[model samples]
Target: MDERQAINAGKAALITLAVICLGALGVLVWEYATTKEVTNTAAVAVLLVSGGLFWAFERMFGAEAPRSLLGRELPTGATAAERAERRRAYAVDALALAISGVVLGIGGFMLGDPDAFGSLGLPGGPVTGAVLGFVALFVISFSLSWLVGEADSRAVEKRLARLEAQV
Candidate 1:
């Protein structure tokens, strides 16, 4: 296949794999909730839903997407080389997104802290803390995975472009 075709194929494969993983995750999450406590169910549900959402987002809006989708949004026009460069930048941007998720998680933990919330005049206690903790983990893990997948797609696209250029 050509450079663009190969990149698209890789993206499709990754999305398919993510969908399969989410299927298994759903089952496991259900079992975890039923076997454990009811309070823990929301955490698992959030984790699973967030993961699915992240994967779907990446599948729809990776390196290959913004080119076609955002071109109308920017009339400046982009050459093949510029598109390739954008792919690289998108890969780096994914990392920034992952870092943002981490930072948000840290802030969530602080805000959700029992003692900390008391000072804030909205203390909900451990249940609140645990729920927030689960949300943090879910958001962090899902965001990181989604970013990594997009970055991987960008790398694949860039590599394919280089190979095509060499040939």
Candidate 2:
């Protein structure tokens, strides 16, 4: 198959893997919450298998093709409404980041507080680790969104260039 087709196939495979991993993780979490014993082996195995599959696919198909999903695509000469829509995309992204940061911050605060879940009998080290983990999640999430937005802007510029060349 051509590179584009291969890349699409790889993306589909990765997406399927992600869904399966998430499902398995959800099951693990549910069992742990209900029974107090972590049934995480299956989830771990799924993650390992998916990671191997992704590595193999990347080796076979090469790097992924550049892609952008900024809500709506704009043409070479965008209308005023389209320009506004583009700005709205960034605004929506900022709103999402703000919301996520708040949620993560709350979680981190609750976990760090010994009184929040006193019955669980979590040790201080684990609580500290969990709090730090949430902080890392907040930072990583915002960084990823920023990187993706930058990539989308570059992709739009390239698309505009191609459209101008055709004129």
Candidate 3:
């Protein structure tokens, strides 16, 4: 396929995957609460409903840039300082998102089976793979945001500095 077609396909696939994931996650919570496994038909119905809701949400709150769907990084502001600041901001955001995802995923996993992790002789070891997978998901989203066009880097830098000073 051509580059454009490939990108489009990739975007669609990613969105669908995310939607299905949401449904599966719902199933997990449901199963945990009820202690009953979901049947194939119920699972499929839940998946469809959840996916539709997610799609609707996306449509209602569309991205500012269409290129973002195709993994285009945003442009930074002009001047060296502005560019540096933008890069730093992106890196910080990406790292924070990735770390948060992994941490939360591991926490949830442990909550579900605390002894399972401790028994492994390595705390967090049992859930490490799943945690990393969650982090990867966050990283993908961050990477796509990073691909958007450059912003007013100087403004961003000043705002970040102010926020840092406030903390």
Candidate 4:
């Protein structure tokens, strides 16, 4: 397909994925509200599907956009800087996803066992776990993002140097 057509297709696919995600989320919420019970199966399905969507999104539009998502190599058309930027964007997206997963996992655990935290003498129960999990997720995600960004920068610099030497 031509570039414009490919872009349009990608956009359509993204919208469809988003709608599917929303529908899944709605079902999850409805199930929880009606049952008044923590459903691990539904929650896990949502998380897994969401994570798959995130990965698909990154593969489709991040550093590999210039090439087909199924392609194994980076396209020659993308400059080092552009690739680096895309990599950084992917890192941020991944970090956000990690944080979300942590929160969701903790929330699920809390809902499944209300007294799990109370036995520890924590005043606010799951709130304390949520807070701690958030802090830990932030720290871990930030560190990982920084490392990925640094690696991307190094790769870009090396590519630029090689290009400069060839000229």
- Predicted model with the maximum lDDT: 4
TM-score of 4: 0.42
- lDDT string for model 2 (33-125, tens) is 999998578787887787888667655543332222444543322467744554555455555665565565557567675443223455674
lDDT of 1 by residue, 1-167 (tens): 76467568667766776676676667666776787634455555656676776566555434442322123221112467755565455445454555555555556657764343123333676445444555555566545544654465565466557668999
For candidate 1, report its TM-score. Answer: 0.34
What TM-score, computed on C-alpha atoms, does each candidate reach?
0.34, 0.44, 0.36, 0.42
As for candidate 4, its clashing pairs are: none
lDDT of 3 by residue, 53-99 (tens): 66554443322232223355443446778556555656666676677
Rank candidates by TM-score, best first.
2, 4, 3, 1
Better of 2 and 4 by TM-score: 2
Give one digit per residue, the lDDT tens place, for model 4 in 97-137.
65786667666675796643335566676767666666666
lDDT for 133 (candidate 3): 59
Off by over 4 Å in 4: 38-50, 64-135, 147-167
Whole-model lDDT per candidate: 0.53, 0.59, 0.57, 0.60
Error at 150, model 1, angstroms: 13
Candidate 2 residue pairs in clash (backbone atoms < 3 Å): none
Pairs clashing within candidate 1: none
lDDT of 4: 0.60
